[model samples]
Target: MATRSAPPSDNLLARIALRFTAFTERWLPDAFGFVLVGTVIVLLLGLATGQSPTALIDGWGKGVWSLVTFTLQMAMIIIGGYALATARPVARVIAWLATIPRTPRAAITFTAAASMITSYLNWAFSLIFAAILAKEIARLVRGVDYRALGAMAFLGLGTVWAQGLSGSAALQVASAESSPKAVQEVIKAGRGTGLIPLTETIFLWQGIVATLIVFVVAVVTAALIAPSGERAKTAADLGIELKPLISPLEAEPKGRPGDWLERSPVFSVLIFAIGAWYLVRHFVNATGSPLNALDLNTINLILLLLALILHWRPHRLVTAVREGAPAAAGVLLQFPLYGGIFGMIAFTGLSATIAGWLVDISNPVLYPALIAIYSCVLGVFVPSGGSKWVIEAPYVLDAANQLQVHQGWMVVVYDLGEASANLLQPFWMLPTLAVLGLKARDIMGYTFAMFLVCFPTVLIVVTLFARTLSFP
Candidate 1:
């Protein structure tokens, strides 16, 4: 007969991570204030690095508006994704999945698995779907822990999104149309480096393996730290009650011809038909080709078209937008402030200085790890992957060229690092926490558990796999 060993403790690393999470909760302000702090930090760095006050201030002013087009794209992605999640069919699916768990351990584990898979489809959908699903499961399964389940939902974004179809940095670098002008220009400057195809990044074996590892680790961690019995909080205990945000039934307007048009499915179906045609033609044209057109634009267009088709009625789409708009408010409010920080970093040459320091320390073998670590730190201050890539891609790509590193692996490393930092950074949690009616502190503990469990996995996988791809 064998005796089972004692269950593992949270470990020193996990304890430290939890302590850091607690410290930040007490001291760190909301996402808006976080960006404001970032702006100040960037400004001070600019001044300290010998930039004139006039130039620094002017850079911030111009930078704040530099991302107008990109901002619109991001906004559409969020709202469109939310609209897709709000569809009755999607809600029904989530509700069905919520009933599949029989125990608290099974509930948390299943939530983590489902959330990670959904995140790999689209981060926005993952956020809304997982939050609602967790709540639904908690309501259905007595003694389920809302805090653990909520953290699992949020953990998906921090874990698998970097390897996902809608991942911001990966999609941006994979196609010219999806990349910002700044990123494209930098790619142009890099020697023999042009658009990186997703086949080499997201579709690669390394990416697939790393993502699988992350999902497994996340689920296991959720199960390991989950509370039991009286410690568990049910849906009611957590005060999470979700109502239908978008109603399928539209109220008809009296005596107005346009009202009929607005409420009819015919026009919306026609519009979605056009979008469907574009998507089909896009893939058809690239059949059997190495070059493809799947990017952020494609992802957003598909999301929008799907939402329109699902909603059927034009007025329902409007209602869905109204429902989803609040979740995206934080993105709109904080993105421009980050745009300014981007300006300060890019225009003031701070990014170059940082990049140069890394290049000086990096050999071929060390480059991937160094890039990953650097991107993790950068992700904390600028959580927008597209925005962060716009600033970092130029120097990062240039260094990769010099070191003979594969651009695909370089992009992958950067993406993994950014996603890793999401464990510590709570910017993306604003919408998620709002929907779940939980505080950041409630979820951060489990998120940090995942971070401790998965960060080294990312570091090791990317570092080793990048070498193989680059050398081979």
Candidate 2:
């Protein structure tokens, strides 16, 4: 692997951050190992909650495979996204962005903005897009801090994804059919509010405003603390070499008909034609709304189609996908472990126990804030936004009704907290790190810095906006 340059002596904050980054690099385990440790911690928590070891083991066994579909979806997202990023047009765009950031300061800020905006469109897209963009920036910018730029790009997701179109919690609450069990229970209890429209949640003026604020603060934060001089990483520090996707071998003659087929665009174009039809059909079938059609599977299919169209040849797309697969292997290996942990939490009633305590201590005025805090804590363990909401929503909804707080406000609060807590969670960073050929340690310190800056910002934003919604 590549080595970073020495930390700068002049900037105290930069020096401290570099030291911290080095410390984490030296001490932190690989992403798979880190999640394995997290699984063990969750197992202990299950046992502490009076679950029998035998039952907990069984729950883990069952839970480990529960996310099979989701795992495939996530893996497709990474692999497909990476392939899409390698497309000629996409590479040109990245090259253009890379040239724009003439300095280290501009590099990180541009990365932050690009990541935030793209991630708002689709979280999966954000992962590979930002990493690829950062890689190009590192290649182009002379003094760019590679590690910092990588971390900042990754940080952009947690900073704004919860308020975006693909946000699991917001979308979940917006759809009655897919709403969490707790939300359903609230309806049965006569205390639950009806389905919240996306307009009232993710598309609300406050949420939009808050997301813009986060984007601005994140850019400013990047500007303030970006390492300079010796502290920054050159492209050489990456240790990995960058290559254009267009191979010279592709221009050489193919040996057989199958080889010719693979090199031809006909197959890919045909596939895209079918996929495009399906997508159009899907959206048309939706009752005059497309937001309901947005989800992991849909996004994955669309991305696959885009990649095929952009790459223009079956063989090239296949090669690009193969190259990208390893980056997603961490997710494949660890999500089952996470699934096991989820099983223990869900089966053993630990989620309810924790939520119950929060309800017990919460009052009307403090309910939203407390729930937001609770969501943040829970988010660390169950970083899957939709799943976390499933566990927290029932009790939180019941409690909110009793406290006379608006249920929509509760969803907003949970969304903010969940996204904020992901700042500290490394699970979501695996693909980006893998793509960048870096470890968690390289990015942890910077991401932690982002957390310090964003967590409070999110809390304050949620509180203020929630108050407005509740009062109105």
Tens-place lDDT per residue, model 2, 372-443, is 788888777777887777777777777776777767677777877887777776878888888888878788
The deviation in Å at residue 33 for candidate 2 is: 2.1
Give one digit per residue, the lDDT tens place, for model 1 in 315-342: 8889889977776677677778877877
Q: What TM-scores do the predictions have?
A: 0.83, 0.92
lDDT of 2 at 130: 93
RMSD to native, candidate 1: 5.2
Against the true structure, candidate 1 reaches a TM-score of: 0.83
Best by lDDT: 2
- List all candidate RMSDs to the true structure: 5.2, 2.8
- lDDT for every model? 0.75, 0.79
